[model samples]
Structure formats: C-alpha cells, structure tokens
Target chain A: MPVRPLKTKVEFPKMLNSERIQVTGKRVQLMATCLCDAFYDDVAIATVQVLEYLGCEVVFPESQTCCGQPAFNGGDWDASRKVVRHTVKAFEGNDPVIVPSGSCAAMIFHGAQIEFEKEADKDSVAALGKRTWELADFIVNGLNKTTWEGKFESTIAFHRSCHTRGTKSSEASLQLLKSIPGISIVEFGEAEQCCGFGGTFSVSFPAISSSMGNLKLEHVRAKNPDLLVSADMSCMMHLAGLASHEGKPIKAKHVIQVLRDALKNIGLIK
Target chain B: MAHQLIDTFATRLRPETKAAVYDGSKKGHEKRTKLLFDNYAKPDDLRKLAGKIKQHVIENLDTYLPATEERLKENGINVHWASTAEAACNHVLEIMRARGAKRVVKAKTMVSEEIELEAFLNKHDIECLETDLGEFIVQLDHDKPSHIVKPIIHKSRREIAELFEKNGLGAYDDEPQVITRRAREFLRKKYLEGDVAITGANFVIAESGRIVLVTNEGNSRFCLAATSCHIAIVGIEKILPRDRDLALLLNLLGRSGTAQELTVYTEFISGAKASTQPDGPQAMHVIFVDNGRTDVLASDCKEILRCIRCGACLNVCPVYRQASGHAYRSVYPGPVGAVLSPLLLGKNFPQKADLPKASSLCGACNEVCPVDIPIPDLLLRLRAKAKQEGVPSPGTPPMGGWAVMASQPAAWKAALVAGKLINFMPTKLLPVPPLRAWEKTRDLPEWRGGAFRSWLKKHNS
Candidate 1:
C-alpha cells in the first residue's frame, strides 16, 4: 500500500458572519483535562473562546481540576476518593459540567458513579455524576434544539478515542463536525482504537506503545487529510510524536481549535 | 523452565516482529470484542449485569461450586477437585495411567497450560499433541503461545509454511488454506490414534454438570469424539447456575472472543457417550481445578473468578497489544492473564511479579469485559501484593523511596523539587535507565515550578 503523508497546511476561506448569528442562548462549560493543564493549555483556551463565540455562557470553574481518572484507574481508592470529592464539590451545582476530552468526561460522568457507589461519599458522587457531559455530547444532545452556524471551509479528519466511542457512546463529535457549513469531514480507518498513549502504559511499555501508534499513524496518513482533529490531546500527542518521528507532514489539532479558528474568521469571537 | 520457554520464543520472534503481530492481533481482538458487546446486551446494560453476576458469583462461590460438582457427578461424569496446579496435573496423569493412555490429542485448554500438563505427560513417556491449528503451530515450533485465543498469532503465513516444510509434513506454500489443510491432515491422524482427548470448557453448567466447549474450527468436537476417553479440564469459576444462563454467556463469548453470532461449534457434553453412540469417547471426565482460584476466591480479589476466558479484555488492553502474550510467560495473556496468572501460579513462579505492571489502566479492557472483573483494579492489587511479598520487580526503584515520600511531607516536597529540576533537562539526559523505555517514544512534560498546594497558597495569600 502506498503511504501518502498528510499535508499539515491548507488554505481555508473566511467564514461568513451571517451563520455565526444563528447560534444564541446556549449554556456550556469548558472542561480543561489534566493534560491540557500541564501540556496543551492552548487547547483549553481555544475551547473556552469557541464556546463563548457560539453565544454560550462558558463557565470555567477555578476549583475544577483533574478528573480523578489517574487515581481511579490506578486502583488507589483513597486518592481517587479525595479527587472525586473535590470535583463533586466544584461542579455538582452546575446544570452541565462540559468537558473537552471525552475520556476524562466519561470517567467523571460515568466512571465516578461506579467508583463511589457504596462509599461513605455516595450522595456527593451521585450528585456530580448527574451533571457531567462531554462537550460535543452536551452540544449535540442537550443543546440540539439550538441551531449553530459553523462556517469552516477545510477538510478535517476526526479520530474517535476508544473511551468516547465505547464507554460514553457519544457520537456528537461527528455530529458537530457534520454541522459545520463548509467543512468536509473525512473518516479515518480504525478511528476508535487507542493511539497507544495510555497515560502510564505509554511509558511502561514503549516499544508496544510505539507499535500501536505506528498503526494509528498509518491510518491518519492514509486519509491525506488537511488536519487530524480529536477530542483528546493525549491521543493527539502520541500521534503527533510518531508523526514527527517519522517526519510526516500532518498537523494534529484539537477539534476545539478548529471551532475557535472558524469562529474567529467569522468575527464571532470579538 | 516456563520462563525459559517464554524467553526462547521471545528471542526467536524478536521484539519488532512480535510488536507487528501484536498490533494486528489487538486490532482483530478489539473489533471482535466491540461487536460482541454491541450484539449481546444493551451497551448501557452490560456493566450493571457484569457487576451483578460477578458479585453474586464471588459471594456464593462455596455454595455454587459444590452444587456444580454434584450435578456433574449426578450426570454420570466423574468430577475431580484439585487444590493446586501440581495436584491438578497429578490428578490428570493418574487418570491417563488408569485409562492406559500412551498418546493424547488435545484441544485448546489454558487450564492445561496453567498446570503445565503437556510437560508432565511428556515426562511420564506419554505423547501429547495439540490439535488446534494455532496451538499445533506453536507446539511444533516449541514456542510458548503469544495470544490466548490465537496461539500462533505471532507467526505469519510464511513462517507457518516454513515450519511445516521443516517438519517434512507439507510443501512450502505461504497460503493460510494450504497451511490449515496440512495441519488438519497431520492432526486428524493423531486424533484418531490417540487414546484420550483433552479440552477446556468455556462454562460448566451447575444445573446439568455439563461441560460447554466453544470453538471456531470444530477441532474441539473432533478432539472430544475421536478418542476413547475425553477430559474437560476447567477452573472452578467456570460454573453457571443453569442452562438458561448459557444464552447470555454464549452471546457474550462468541462476540467478545471472535465476533461471531455463535462459534462454528458449540458442544455441551454431560457425560461419556453411551453404548448406543458409535463415534464418541467411551469415558468422559470433568476435572475442576482450583489451583490458586480458591486463594483468589477467599480474598478481596475474588472478582477475578468471574472471568469467562473470552479474551475481550486482552483484545482491548494497550499493554497486551505491545508486548503480546508470551511476555506474560503464562498460558493466559492480556488484562485477564496479568491478574489471574500470578494468582494461579503463586508469587514464587519465577518472574511472576512482572505481570502486574504490564497495563496502562486505560479502562478499555474493563469497558470491553463481559463479566466486569475490574481488571485494572486487580492488577494494582497484585502489584501491592507483590511489593508486600518482597518480590523484586525488574525495572523499579527500591520501595524505600516510595516509603519516604509517602509518609513524610517534607521529604515528599524535597523529592518533588528534585523531580521538577530533573524534568527541566532533556529526557535523554534524565540519567534514569529504567525511564529510557518511556523517553524513547514520548517527551516528558516540562514541570513548572511549585506544587499544586503551593500554587494555591500563593494565589490565596
């Protein structure tokens, strides 16, 4: 099979302002995942800017922090308990705790309930669990009645991380992409498979990790996409690292960045 | 000796080749597992059902196990309980001797691998032949299995052809059908000639004492039918309360393991064939092996018992995809194997301690698991247990560092400061050899000064 490396830079037309006026009276929250805090802070900023541009009140809770996924996944019950307790305290009163990353949101929204079911803090866990939402899921399912005019003229390939596709069952990323006025969304093969950057597993088993990333890289390359976008930065980092190592030309960006850029071109972010 | 087998196989296969095979196998396993979960139960309903079933099984194990044994015995099948792997191996050897069996043809059985049955039988001058195509390929190459369901997944078609040609049993043709036909011709004769056939049961129905074998190639059926005596070796946890439960389980098994509506063959045998049956084994035996299952059953980690051997968890696990199965050096591999293997073989099984750290705790395995063993949880528990037992882990620093950091806040802060300083340097210059594995593939995030608590303190003050 001939492997055509994706071109990172592609020209995009200025979005029309008329479409931006259509989206109004929506509420959203920006969930800045742990990786976004430590590494990809730009993605978090873009997420907030984009949500605000869509006429949604983007609530950024200063108390909101790591989603307790690391401790929960590591089986450290005490640590997980402390983290979830803090998270529940921070976001429980909100209508919807919107998260940019699907996996972290799923962990907070779905996995936390399971983790705290019979614990002493059961009521608090249940309270927060009821309000959690992946950004796309909240936009498509919860805010579906509100129409949004997204005018982005570019080819984008969407990569669905495993947790989002399997656990959360949120296809809103695709729905949101499809709703864009001028963007052509392409599907990558095996989009749901892990990019192999499994938090700690990537470090613990590097050869196997890279091997998995190689397969994902092949998929991303096959599309010859203008840009590869995903809900999670951890996967993007893994794919981008492999792409960089292989000297491939494909650029990876968070879906929120695309939304932010498009909104900017339409003068919606002003 | 088991470690040696794994090392030999791993060395011969090499890391890159093994990695490529692992990537393909992982993709295949993931596709099948997802299809299985989607088809069998409402995606939202699986976790609840899996949790309930596992909880019920663990709480009432003593009650259910005996009920299952009694039912099997009542249906004219001999049921033997083995407390350990050695005991299980001895029990089978005793049966083999009593049957006057000199040769055996076997279907795929992880229990046999758990107890190292083939080696034991071979030591006693009896020949044991693996009949499953993947298994037979691994057997002929004298290599350990790199996958649970597909034992020879590490081998390409060309490798199989080469191996077959070297054995002088077939022509060198790099075609799957040609290789499969050659293996069938070779194993068919052995199956008919063997005195006994041994296979693993997917689930042992507690109500009927029947052993259920699920297979894609129908080789299990041939293995059970062609010999004079048939043996179904299984873990005690394979018991289900009734036949009605089979519908749900079979649905999960087919989809989770191989992504089929049902396996090519689903055979439920309660006992040996009666005199009226012309082509079935005359004597049937079901050996229920406990090994360390009872130990796991007695502890907080009893949820590991609810595993159905579907290999769904393995398919979705990122670590298993990279390292493949042989790195585990056990009959079982992947998320399920990482937790269960150490328990079954005990802490003293050489290099058994390495199994616990083999996962990324991605939760993918838990998501795909039909029975919801909480695989990542068990893996962490095993790691703690291994640390407690003072089992030396391969690439980890001494626990003294962890002890100091965990108990003393000042020490922890100091260590964090040092770690932050180290993170500022290029990862290539980090001076930690153990961390090289990580740095080779990813750049360590540069640490900003100050801890979270410190940052909060400064902002509030």
Candidate 2:
C-alpha cells in the first residue's frame, strides 16, 4: 500500500485570527522539525496555518532546524548538543517555541538538559528548555485564553507519541482535542504505549519495530475512527505505514492538520 | 549455585529463536504501554503515585517490620530475621533439622536462589524439589531461572521436551499440555511425599502477618497444604502496612505479570495451620531475609526496595529480550534484576558488573512497573556505584562514550575530527574488534564538516 500524502498546501498565518486566543501582541515561533522540514513539510505548514487562523502572530525561524532527537536517541550526546545549541539560539527571544512534533518538543523541553548537561552552553540550553512547548500545548495553554467557536462533527482518535505522552506531558494535546466543538475524541485503550517508532529504532530493528506498529494499528482499528491524529509524525508514519499495508482504511493526520481542517470549515483559512 | 545451575541447564537445552520472538513482543508491548499511558493520565499524576508508594514503604519500614512480625506471631507463625544470605540459609537449615525434614518440596522463590539454598540443602543431605512448573523445568535441567516469572522463557516446548526425556520423564513432545502433564506426574509424588514445603511470599501483610502467594499452576497451593512443615521465605521489603493494600497490588500484579485480571490462585496464609484445620501444615515458619536489602533500603538506592517482582519490567525491556536472563548471570535478570542482583550478591559476583549496563535506558521497565521503580535511573546509578566501588566490569562495551568525551570541549572537538576521518573505514580496517558490533549493524553517518560553535560564530558575527 502506497503511503497517502496530505495534498493541501499547509501554511501558517502571520497573525492571531482566533478570538479564542486573547493574544495582545505576544510573539510565537513555529519549530518546523527536521522530519517536518524534510518529509512532513505539510505538517509544518498546517501548524502555521492553524495558529494564524487562530489569530496569533506567528514567526518561522528559518534559522530553526532539527531538535536533535535523532542524535539524542542514537546516544550521540555531542551531535545532539550541536543541534540543540542551534535550536536554542534560533528561538532565543521568542516567548514560545511551538513545535508540531511531540518528540521534537520533548527534546527541546526536557531532553536538552541531558544532551547539554556538561557543555559550555548548558545555561542557554536550559533556558530554551524552559520555554519550549509542543504545538498542541502552545495552542491549548500558551495561547491567550479564548473560547473557540470552531466546530467539527467528525469522530477522530488521538495517539500520544511515546516521548510526548510517556516522558513529557499529554494534557496539552487532550485539552486541544477537547476544544474542537462537536468533534468526539474517541479514546484508545493503552493509548500511552509507544507506537514502536523509536526514531532509528524502527529501521535498526525492523521486525520488532513493525510488530510494535502493528499492535498500535490494531488498537486504532478497534476505535473505528474516521481519522487518527497524533502529535508526532514519526509515530504516525509508522502506524500509517502498517495500517496502509494491512489494507485498513483508517487515515493518519497530525493534530495540527485536524485543527487546521476544522478552522478551514469556519472560513478562518483559505 | 546459580552460576553452576545456569551452566548445567544451558548446556542441556537446545538453543532456539525465542529471543527474536521476545524482541518483537517487547517492542509491541512498549508501544502499547506508551499509547495507553498517553491517553490515560498526566505524567505528574503517575509520578506522584510512584513517589507516594515508594516514600511510604521506605520512611516507616522500621514500624512496619515490627508490626508485621508481631502480627505473624499473633497468628501463630514464627518470623525469623536474617541479616545476610548465609544467615537466612542457616535459619532455614536449622528449622529443617529441628523438624527432622529429609525431603523438601519448593515453590518459586528468588530469595532461595539468592542464598543458594539448594546447594546448602544438598550439602546438608536434604533433597529439595521445585514444584512450580517453570521452577520445576529449571530444577530438572539443573539451571538458574532465565526470567523472574517465566524462568524457562528462553526454552521452547521442544527443548523442554528434550530435557524431560533426558531426565527419563518422557519423550521430546511438541505439545504444551503433554509436557505439563508429564511435569505434573513427576512432581505430584514429591508434593505428597515431601516432609517440608517451601515457597516465596508475594506480599507480607503487616496488619495481619499474612503471607500472600499468587500463582497460576496451583503448585504453591498444594505444596503449602500437603507438607507437614511449611516455610515461606520473603525479603523484608515485601511487607505492606495493611491487608487493604493487597487489593491494589493484586490488581496490578496479575495484569503486569501476564496481562490477566487475576491469577488462578491467590492464597493468603496468616499462620501455622489452625489446630481445627485437618489439612494445614503442622508447622509454619516465615523467614524475612534482609541480605543487603536493609543496606539498599538505608542507602540512596532504597527506591529499588519498592519492587514487587511482577516482572512486567522484564517482559517489556528491549535489552532483556535480546540478551535473555542468563547473560546477566544473576537470579534477578531484567531491569530489577540488574540492580537488585548486584545489591543482593554483593557487587563481587562474577559478571555482576555487566548487569547494570544491560539496558538501552528506554524507561519501558519504569512505565510498566506496578510499583513504579525508576529502573533505568536505578540502573544508571548502579553503574556509577559499581565504577566507584572499583568492581570488575561486566565485560560489555561502554555506551555513551561521547557523553564523557563531550564533557571536555577540546577532547570532543578532537574526537569529532577523528570520528570524521574514520567514518569511511570498513570494520576490517578498524584497529579493534569492539567496533565490529556497531559496524556490522549500522553505518557511521557523514560528519557535517563543521561544529555548531563554528557555524554560530560565523552566522551570529
């Protein structure tokens, strides 16, 4: 089964549009992760478009690159430090560095401490760690409190990525999902389990990684949702690949994509 | 004794591909746990629960210990405390000798394994028989348990059949039922004829002085009931403050151990068989073994005392699935084993030092642990402790060499240059064989040609 790619051109608005976020000129930067930069560019675009549609001033630090999760997971602390130092420097002055990928956000938020603990730039890394937020977290918590008027009636299942859900926090994603008026969020059993895509772990140990993905696919199918959404594309890609290969009709989408699609219905985005 | 038993048992069993199956299953289990954890609760909530339980157990252990001893005594049970493994073993031996016990039937007990009880018993001329199905398999083959719960997880049915046949129990059978029946027939006689029965307690209720034993095979139940003298050996850390706590533990134990709602039998023995009860053991003894556990409890590693031995951490651990348990060369094999074994056996056991390094620090063990011991964190601490203690290394290659190198910027820069220069070299061209492990499986990625500091220096300037 061929992987289905989202065709819509994902783009972020330059300013806060949602009446829900009571933003009084606070700046938010979008962290288009390495994977988002290379493969899931649509997710980065969708994240920006949704935040813009929400009426928040959005900035994309082109100087931004990967969050160094790839190196971190591989046990290459120095390589991860290099990437993290770049990331911390890129979003230095931004109030919130919103990352669409849960794994990347987790790295910036929590993993940077471990990655740069003994480095000369540890103090700067620690500062960036304090301000980093997963995009859903930024949308739900960091956003100025505004009652969302957007509504979507479709049933969707949300998958929490391992690092985001297990290591970091999941309340941000859950709260964001709850805000979508009329959209029923179907809860999954054992939903906090990893989707088996441990970055390079999937390819390094394909058979085991695939089996893990297959189990996640089984649970997702159990919910019988119209779409599966998650904070991490690496996990979504793994689950989507298995679901597609098994001939399941369930489609995987980033949480931002779902929020973007909902906003588009309300005429908030073109 | 575990070393000897492992060598003997491993020599007899034919190697199979169960390791591969375990690897796949663990990945699947970890993925499921992550997905479920994400959807169910907040990280802070989970962390709070883990912290609360551990703190409760450690802070008032003194009060709980005496309370539990008094309660057991009130229920007509004798509680013996052993500060060391040798002390524990001698206590059991004295009990057996005083009772004139010649033959003993045993249930699964990691404490017994820690103290090398079988060897001690053998030396004293008392025959000991393992009655639990998995323990029986290991006993018959004269092997150490490869797993805490599933001792024979590394052995396929065919290999078990072969072991049984070698022992004159039956032919090499492919069916589980056939093999189980054969093991039952062989052990049933021992259960009836044995003079003493011994088992491990899953939890020791401090309020009631009751020893709670959970098992699926009914072996422990039969062994506890049929023998004249019964000895329940438990680690001191197994004590809980109240009977009510058992419900929470039992609920999580079964699910975490085997994904079942409950085991087949959950037996609670408070004391010696009541005088009115005709089938109860004539004498009941509960030996609470300290054996370095108090040291662990008193030290910074006290959180490890919270382990309930559910083995959920082992089932979900990626490194354990690959290496199997024997590689650790300890009675405790996975994450909990890696830390606990070193503490129990005194950092001097051969191959003990390698046990701590046997993980990817994936934290899957911590997640599935019902008691929520931060196993990966503990393992790291153990490694640091071992290094500080100057124990012989466990012979595994060092991981995170980069982290150490990165601690020194000049050294890191020089290492990066060397790494870039060697990136293209084949495994055969390397000066050492240790690099082969990484080279055989993964490729070294090309260096980016410049450091982040250099790039930042140019761009920011």
Candidate 3:
C-alpha cells in the first residue's frame, strides 16, 4: 500500500475558535517517534491532522530521533542518557511536548529518574517530563476536547499501551472513541495485556515475545473486530504484523488514525 | 547456554499455557478480581499494612524468633532450626524415626516440595501419603506440582479422574464434585491410618508460636488434629509479630491467590497438648527452615520475602498466564518465582540469569501484588546483575545500534534508510532473531517510498 500525505486543512472545531487556543497558546511540539518516522508515517500525519482539527499548531522537530527506550530498558543507562539528552535538547521552547507514541513518551516521562538525575539541569529535565504527553492523552485530557463532530463507527479492539498508565491515555482513548457515532468496541479476552512490544524486550526474548504476541492475537481473534486499534503505534505495529503475517483480515491503526479514517469516511477531511 | 535453555523452554511452553489459559480458568478470575476490589475498601492501604508487618518481622527476626522458640517450648512444642534443605529434611526424618512412624499423611507444602521431602522419605521405605486432592493426584502420577497453590493446575479434570481410577480409588465420574468426594473418602482412610501427620504452616506466629494454615479442603485439620504426632515446616520469614496480623495477611492471601472471601478452613496449631488434654497431637514439632530465606531478607530483594504465596501475581501476569508454571522451571512459578528463584537459589541456578529477562516489564505483577513487592523493579535489578555476570542478554546488539543512531540525526537518518531497505527483504533473509520472531506472528513494516522526515521536509517547504 502506498503512503499518502495527510490533508492539511480541515474544518477546525469551531467551539475552540479564539477562546480555547489562547489558553495554552495553541502551541505544541510534536515528537514524531522513531517508529512513526521510519515505519508508520500515516499515524504521524493523522496525529498532526487530528491536532490541526483541534486548532493547535503542531511543530515536528526534525532533530528528534528515537526515544532511547531500547537502550534505557536494556539497562545501559549511560547510552540511554546520551540519547535522552539529545531528545531533551531537540524539543525546546516551552511548548507542551506531544508524543504520538506512548512507549516513547513513557520512556522520557518514567525514565527521568535514571535519565536525568545526574545532569546539571536535572530539575529542568524533570520539568520537561511533566510537559510530555502521549497524543491520545493530549487530545483527550490536555486539550480537554470531548465530543467529535464527525461520525465514525466500527468494532475496534483497543490495545492499552503499557507505559501510558500515568496519563491514563488508554482509558482516555476509549472514552474519546466512544464520542464518535456508531463505533462499537469488541472487548477481547486479553485486551489489557501488553502487545509484547517492550522496546528491547521483543528482541531479547523473541520466542517468548512472539508467544505473548500470539496470545494477544488469539484474544482479538476471538472478538473478530473490524480493526485492531491502539493508542501506541508500537503495539499496533506488533499486532498488525502478526495479523497480516497470518493473512488475517484485521488491520491495525493508532487510535487517532481510526478517528481520522472515520472523518475521511464521512468526507469531513479533504 | 542461557539462550539454549530459554529456547528449550519455549518449545514446551504452548501445551502448559493452553491448559492454564484455555482449559483452566473456567472458575472465572473475572468475578474473583471484582470481588477482591469490592470486598476491600482500601486495598492499597491493606497492601501497605501487610508489607509493613512483613518487613518488621524480617528485620527483627533474630530477636523475635528466639522469643517465639521460647514460647513454643513453653507450650510443649519442639522448635528445630534448619540452615539448609538437607538439614530441614534430616530434622523431619529424625523426628519420624524417633517415633518409629511408618505411615505419614501430608498436606500441601511448597517448602517440603522444595526439600524433596516426599521422595526422600519414600526412598527410605516409609509410606508418605499426600492428603490434598491435587497433591494426591500429582503424587499418584509421580509428577511434580506444576503450580505452588493449585499444584496440578496444568492437569485437566479428565486426567484427574483417570488418575484416581488408575490408582484404584473407584470409578468416579469426571465431575469435579465426584472427584473431590472420592478424594475425601480416599484420604480419610489415610488420615485415620497414619501414625504421623505433616503439614505446611501458612504463617508461624511469633507471639503465640502457632502455625496458621488455610485450605479449601479439611485435610489440613486432620493432618494436625487426627494424628498422634504433628510436624510443621515453615520458612523463617513466615514469622509475624502478632497473632492479630493473621487477619490482614489471610485477607490478602485468599483474595489474591484464589479470590475467596476466606478459605474453607483457617486452622491454627500452636501448642501440642495440655497435661490433661484428651485431644490434639501429643507431640508438636515446628521446623524453621532458613534455606536461603535469610539471604533474601538481607539483600536488596528483601521485599519478595513478604509474599504470602497468594499467586495473585501469577494469575494476572500475562507471561505466567501464557507461558504457564513449568516454563518458569521452579517449584514456585510466575512473577513471584521469576524474582524469588534467582535471589533464593543464587545466580548459579540453571538459567538463573535468563529468568528475569523473560518478563516484558509490563508491571502487571507489581500492580496486583498484595504486599506491594516491586516485582518488575527487582526483575530489572536482576537483569543488570545478569548483564554484569557475563551472560549475554539479547538486548545488547539492537540497543547498541539504537543508542548510536539516536545520539546523532545523521546516524538516525542513515539507519532509517537501512531500515527501509531491510524491511523489503523476507524476514528470514534478515539476520536477527527479534525480526524473525516478529515476522512469525506480526508483519514486518512495509517501507513507504520515503521516510516521514523527508516527507515532512517536502510538506513544510
């Protein structure tokens, strides 16, 4: 399948007009994660489109690379810090840093104790951690946008990403999806289980990871959803990879893309 | 060696996992989890209190244990200390030999299993009978208990019924009730005939020097009260400061392990008998088995000692629920075993270094832990130790590349190009186990024409 550019212009939420955008200055820095930058650009674009619809200026910093979770989770603290420092430097200028991927955002948010404790600006790094938000969480809670004007309906199997617990992004995404008209949730057996994409974990224990991923597959397979959706693209990719490998009909998307697709289905985006 | 061991374990993983995840859990954990939260108004506070009491007992064990020993001695109960597994087993053997006891009835105890007590005693021509239904079934089959709490959780009902029939326990149907009744009748005979009773203490009280036990079956009571002599094996860490703490620990234990309001029987064995007492065991011996528990209490992994053996961590753990207990390769399995095994057995245990890395660090175990043991945190600490111990972790090569690429944009962009190119080839042609494993269940990323960074450049320009 070919990748297409996300439609830039859309009818913005008129309710937000001048009153709401001014609250946070409508300024946000987007950390397009390495997974999105390399493999799933559509999720990144849809995230931007979703943000644009919410009336926010989304800045994609080119200097931003990987989130260092791979190194950080592997117990290589020095290398993790080196990568994290560059990321901390990349998203500068006081805008709320929005991450489309929960895994990456979680790495920076939760890993600050080990990532920044020794740094001269440890407090600053910790402050920056507070500013970071996973995209679904940013859209639902940070922006405080509840109802969707556009209608979308499908049986969605939502994979609650592991690291976004503090933000409650997984629950927020479910609530956000419910606002869209006609969408039915297919509750899978292990819907709350991790997608087995724990950065280096998927690689380190591949057989175990693969075994776990298959269990996740069986969970959703029983539900027979129209699509597999998750707040984290990292998990979506893992699930999609498994489904597509088996020639199963299921497709995977980030929760925002599911929303974006619903809008596209109704000709809301051009 | 570590990789091979894990690979070997992975092959046998599915059957046991299928048994637990599919054939098992018909009892419904969903309702159990709901009841646990509903029954306890402040679950977190309860967990904190349980953790606090355990930590207090562990930290002050030296002072408290001697006092407990004195109290038990005054109550006509003998207290024996076992520094090693061999010593613990020998102490029980000496007690049995002293009484000239030939037939022994046993209740479920993971520690006795740890000491290989059944096999040791049976090999010496003594008849050791397991009274617990699941333990009895496993004993008949001459198989190890797959789960600490459930014992034969991996066995199907049909298998249990078949095992019972094969053992000449009569033609009971596969109905759970029928099998349980048959086991009751069968074990009642052993209970009446046995000369000595051996049981595992759920908690050994310091203030009262008593053994507190909980079981669904009433056999534990028989194993204590029906016999002339009774023996209890307990870990040093099982000591609690007061008898009142049993209320808190038992609440967490039953809810977390089996999701019960309370077990069928919560029996206490403190003193042997009064001078004019007509009932209860004439002699009571409580064996305090250290067996590396003190080492666990001394180390940074001390919090794991607070485990009341609830198996809640096992029930919620995605890894445990899928991989099952045998995959863990321990008497104790699941999240608890993953942390406790390496800590208690030392780093030299088979595949000890790889055990911690088996988890995805999803934090499920820590979330559901009754005592609030930071299981995932301990796993990470063990992973660090494993890395330092010269065991090659699968995390190294990819993370090394990820770190280097993430440090510089030029390197990252270059890697992006390489990743795009790599995604085009078949997964087998690609040279990594992670990708190979990824391709087994999930799709490799389909590289679009250009990277999102370049596409962003085009849009912005």
Tens-digit per-residue lDDT, A175-259, candidate 1: 6666777888877776556787765455545655676788888887788888888888778888887777566646888877877
- Model 2 chain B, TM? 0.85
Which model scores highest in DockQ? 3
Flag clash pairs in model 1. A208-B322
Model 3 residue B458 CA deviation (Å) reads 4.7
Where does model 2 exceed 4 Å of error? A1-25, A29-94, A99-130, A144-161, A167-270, B1-15, B19-51, B343-353, B383-461
Model 1 chain A lDDT-worst window of ten:
A10-19
RMSD of model 2 against the true structure = 10.9
Q: Residue by residue across B93-125, what tens digits does model 1's lDDT show?
A: 999999888998899988898889999889999
Measured by TM-score, the strongest candidate is 3
Give the worst 10-residue stretch by lDDT in candidate 2 chain A. Answer: A10-19
Better of 1 and 2 by DockQ: 1
Candidate 1's docking class is incorrect
Q: How accurate is candidate 2 locally (lDDT)?
A: 0.68
What are the per-residue Cα lDDT tens digits for candidate 3 across B30-141?
5457877798777877876687777666667778788888878877899999998999989988998999998889999888988889888988788999998889888899
lDDT of 2 by residue, B1-461 (tens): 01122223323333464443365446546544554455446533443354455457656677778878888889888889989888998998999989888998998888899888999999999999998898888888887788877788777777788898898987778699999899898888778889899999998887777889999998988897678888988988887666786766776667667655678899988877787888968888999988888778766567788887778777776555545677667788878988888777654534475566555455667777776676655665565566556554422333345334433445544654565555566647765443343333233223433343343344335
- Tell me the spans in candidate 1 whose CA falls farther than 4 Å from its real position: A1-31, A50-96, A106-130, A141-147, A165-170, B1-16, B19-27, B30-59, B168-182, B216-218, B224-226, B299-301, B316-318, B346-353, B367-439, B442-461
